[model samples]
Target chain A: MQLPSKLIQDAVEEMAKLPGIGKKTALRLVLHLLNSDKEQTTMLSNALVQMRENVKYCKKCHNVSDEEICNICSSNNRDKSTICVVESIKDVLAIENTAHYRGEYHVLGGIISPLEGIGPSDLSIDLLIERVSQHDSEVKEVILALSPTMEGDTTAFYISKKLKSCDIKLSTIARGVPIGGEIEYTDEVTLGRSIMTRTLFS
Target chain B: MQLPSKLIQDAVEEMAKLPGIGKKTALRLVLHLLNSDKEQTTMLSNALVQMRENVKYCKKCHNVSDEEICNICSSNNRDKSTICVVESIKDVLAIENTAHYRGEYHVLGGIISPLEGIGPSDLSIDLLIERVSQHDSEVKEVILALSPTMEGDTTAFYISKKLKSCDIKLSTIARGVPIGGEIEYTDEVTLGRSIMTRTLFS
Candidate 1:
């Protein structure tokens, strides 16, 4: 859509570049910013720029952090012996929100997706191996907490193979019907897997 | 949700302040930026800042512009004898996209809404009146193309009362069931209005 001002157009175009936002939504957002206080726009712009320029990644797990190591990895309360490997930083946050897991996380940054031209080398898998292989490493188990997608399974298999020689145990998050999900509505593959991996009743 | 870094949290918070965006969506967008090139985030930030700092509004109509006089107002091809009044700059773009309206526009910036504490004085009603009342004014018709909401009708009525003494003709855009809209499914108010204002077939 043609905007009245070039500046507004540029801002809309930039906002549209983000995932899920289209030109129309971008236009609306830009118009909203135009109508709001200049300070609001300035604050948003400064925050984004600061995030890009100053944001750091955990040296070991590649999770977004303000320091060399992420808070989880650096915390004394977190169990460094059990690392939960996931696809992205968002996954790390999702797991953290549960409050059920106290283990440190290894953010893969992404999973192996040949369709997207993302290979194993493109992720932080090598860092995970190095972290688990350190001579003085305290790691005893590496849990694959990735998604249930084919890409997630492939990444899990690849990591398991790479750590086969290590003394640490390798496992994955359970795949099953969600707690509130209706059994009839569950997909065939998930239902079948859940049945096959049924746990013993206490 | 607890974020891993304060910078990420700040960016997410600012983004969430925008209309229609929530914390989860904001985090997703911020993470997408973080995973992509640093230059991409820099460009988006720069564009927003530039738009906020450099954007200007048309002196005549209050539409967004880079110059004091907007392109539509300055264009000789446009009809100076007719002015389409709208609630916002977006409305102007919407009308311009139709390519049917050849007249100039007068953006009111907002409608009179007491609940929102917006009044006629907060808009560009005075400028519009002054423009049409100029000694050598060429304006002959003023079209109220505002929405059909109660606020829109109230604003239109207010404008009509204000321009009652002027020689210019005041009209509103036709309201009816939209073209291609199914008669059976159309809302009662719209259907009623369409029937009441039905025109004779030529």
Candidate 2:
């Protein structure tokens, strides 16, 4: 829709650049900002710029950090021998929220999606290999915790092939019905595999 | 949920302050920005700050503008004798999108809401009256195009009372079943009102 003010139009266009935000929603958001306190708007703008300018990535895992080395990598309480590999920082946050896995993580930055022109070279796979090969490294097991997509599986396979010569054991997160999931609604392939790979009760 | 980095947390908190965004959605948007080119983040931040700093409001209509007098108020193509009153700039854009009305607009900035502590004093109601009172002003009709809600009606009623002595006409937008609405699923109050205020075929 046509807007009368150039400043409003400019603000809406910038906001619409965000993912999942359309022009209409952007206009609504901009209008809300226009009506709100100017200091609040400044705070938001400053926060975004500051985050982009001063944000740091972990030297080891590549996750976002306030310093060169992330807190997770420096923490002595974390299980350094077990490393979980995932695609993005969002995945790292998601897994951390679970409070289940005590192991550290290795962010791949992205999966191996040839269709999208992303390959093993585009990711930090080599750094992972280098980290595992170090004689002083205490890593005993590497867990592939990527999503259950074709790209994730392809990346995991490539990594497994690369790590075969190393003494470290390779494993993957279990594929089965999720907790509180109903079997009747579960897809056939997942259900069949879950049944065939059933584990003995403790 | 706990975030690993302070910078990421600050960005997320600032984003979450927006009208409809939650912590989860804010985190997703912030992470998307972090993963994207740094230039895009700078552009967004600059646009927002620039808009907030340079934005202006029309002297006549109080709609967000880039100059003291908005383009709509200065345009000779629009009907100078008719003025459409609205609660916000968003309503002005919505009505302008219809391309049916060629009249000037007076943005009240907000409707009178007691629960929100907003009263007629907080609006630009006096400026609207003054615009209509000036002898040189050719405003023969004032149309109330506010939303069909209690607050809108209250604000309209107050404006009508204030304009009682003025030698001008006051009008309100018609309310009925939406153009393409299903009658069966429509609420009874709106349907009954539509029937009670039925108009003759054109």
Candidate 3:
């Protein structure tokens, strides 16, 4: 075990804690940081600090934002009556990047995975219910954009049960063989979308 | 034309500046940082700052160090009289990991890569000559540990010329088939080592 300097080791340890980053990758990254210009390294350091300091979840929609309300929630052009519910902030970003959806968003933080000890109460489901109930006059459609997983299915079912008596229309994104996709190896998104868009089963 | 936030973009730009990291990889790294824990992200940020703050080149041997002299230069057990000159700090780490060398090190910062607009003057050749010519009675040998590249060869030749009149035995690491290496695709290290260790250069 060749012992690098304490600073290098600390940088490596912190990098290794990131998703998919191992010790070797961490060392490479740290070495890269060392070789970079002083200003560039400082910028990287400050950017990391600033990212955490600036970003916060919007009080209303729970989407990531640098202010009290997220851009989507605050935009007057967006459809306030349609709230797209996603599993996390990344999902919200993915949806926004498409530029096809002009609706507000709700991030559940995570899906309801009982096996992983994540129950319905662990997510922001209650807050979402409160938002819907309080803004009953404005909300007309609730789009479940959760991940295409068993946990996603369970959470959607739970939320749908809670909103059964409400006048709002419950829907999900279309599932089918995606564009430029191979039908043989189609993922859960394609499969789920295909099934959801299937002709009336009755 | 995906316009990420300025904070995210800054992180990506900084990551892209690293060796072997492309824009896509930089984006991936930024996303990883975004997903990382706040405390761990802060740790990484501070580590980058600390890495820049702590390490500096040793005044005596030019090896990277936190003090005026590097660990090898300060250590009493190492053979200080035999100075092994290399290209960079990474070379020092590589040689140290081998655990076969017990001599001191001198980092030239880089070799004489004329193709890359680097010449003897670009390296620490003058400083190395000064160190060698110093009135230190303990000096016995100078080992060239440069890579077996054209630039490395040119740099070694330049150094050897400068040290020609010095009362010290000059040698280089061997060139030959490496241990556990096949002759078909033997790298420069093994080939160079084999040649250096050869009885005659037929």
Candidate 4:
């Protein structure tokens, strides 16, 4: 489609580059930016650029950070001895939303996906192992909170093997029926796991 | 959720303000931008800023343009005598994509929606009437190509009443079975319209 101007076309193309946004949606977004306050576009543009230019990663856990260490890793109140391992800052946010875990985190960046040619070397697995294996370590347990996909399991297995020599214990989130899921609608594998792993009514 | 960085949090908030994006999708898009080449983010940011700062509107039709008058309005190749009235630039684009209409366009920006408190005075309806009314009249037809909704019908009725003083013909797009639509699945209203407006089978 012929846009009214080159600037519009360029903006639409750029907007369409984002995942899940089609050309029509991109055009709608661009047109919205055009009709909205100039300051809004400026704020969005500046925020994106600022993030791309200045956003740093936590030195210890590889989480996105303004400084070398993220707020989660540096907080004294969090359980430093129990680290939750997962992929990406998004996962960190999701886990934090649950408010169940008070442990420090180990962000692996991404799991071991051979299909995408992403191996152990591509991620921050070494940093996590080193963080757990330090002498006179306070790190006692490493919980693998990665997704239960094949790649996630593979990544957890590789990291656990490397941390075996260390004093840290390895664990994972249990696979069972979701907390609010109805038993009738639950899949067999999950329902069966929930039943098998059921603790005596306590 | 506590984001790892202020930059990320700000960007996510700004991105989430878009029509369909939520916080989670905003984070995903922002993270994707981070992992991609800085050039992509820079280009997107620059395009948005440039478009917002410099985008112009066609003087005659009020469509988005890079110059005073849009190409369609000024072009000698298009039928200047026939003006297609539309609700927004998106409508203009949809019609333009068909390559079916060679007429000029008069963008109303939005329809007369009482619920949204948008009246005829809020649009470019006055400008459209003025264009059709100058002495030494060149205009022959005014096509109401607005959507076939309640608001669209109201706006069309209003414009047709105003254009009654002019010697130009007023028309609307045909509403019937969409191309490639199955007869069994077609709605009753559209099927009835198709029958009522039946033409020569040639």
RMSD to the native, candidate 3?
3.9
Q: Which candidate is the best by DockQ?
A: 1
Could you tell me which residue pairs clash in candidate 1? none
Alpha-carbon deviation at A41 in model 1, angstroms: 0.5
Model 2 residue runs over 4 Å out of place are none
Candidate 1: stretches off by over 4 Å = none
C-alpha lDDT values of all predictions: 0.93, 0.91, 0.79, 0.91
Chain A TM-score for candidate 2 is 0.97
lDDT of 2 by residue, B22-77 (tens): 99989989988988899999888888888888998899999888989999998989
As for candidate 4, its clashing pairs are none
Q: What tens digits encode model 3's per-residue C-alpha lDDT throughout B1-202?
A: 2422556666667767777678777776766777667777788889878987787778888876677777778889998788899998778888998989998887898888877898888788888888888896477899999987788888899999999989999999876676777877987766776777678648
For TM-score, candidate 2 versus 3, the one ahead is 2
* Residue B65 error, candidate 3, Å: 1.3
Residue B18: error of model 4 in Å?
1.1
- Give a tens-digit lDDT track for model 4, residues B1-202: 5788999999999999988889988988999999999999999999999999988989999999899998888788998789999999999999999999998999999999999999999999999999999896589999999888899999999999999999899999888899999989998988998999988898
List model 2 lDDT by residue over A18-81, tens digit each.
9999998898888888888999889999899888889887889887789898999999999999
> For each prediction, how big is the interface RMSD?
0.8, 0.9, 2.3, 0.8
Candidate 4 to native Cα RMSD, angstroms: 2.5
User: Which whole-number lDDT from 0 to 100 does residue A97 have in model 3?
Assistant: 80
User: Which candidate achieves the best lDDT against the true structure?
Assistant: 1
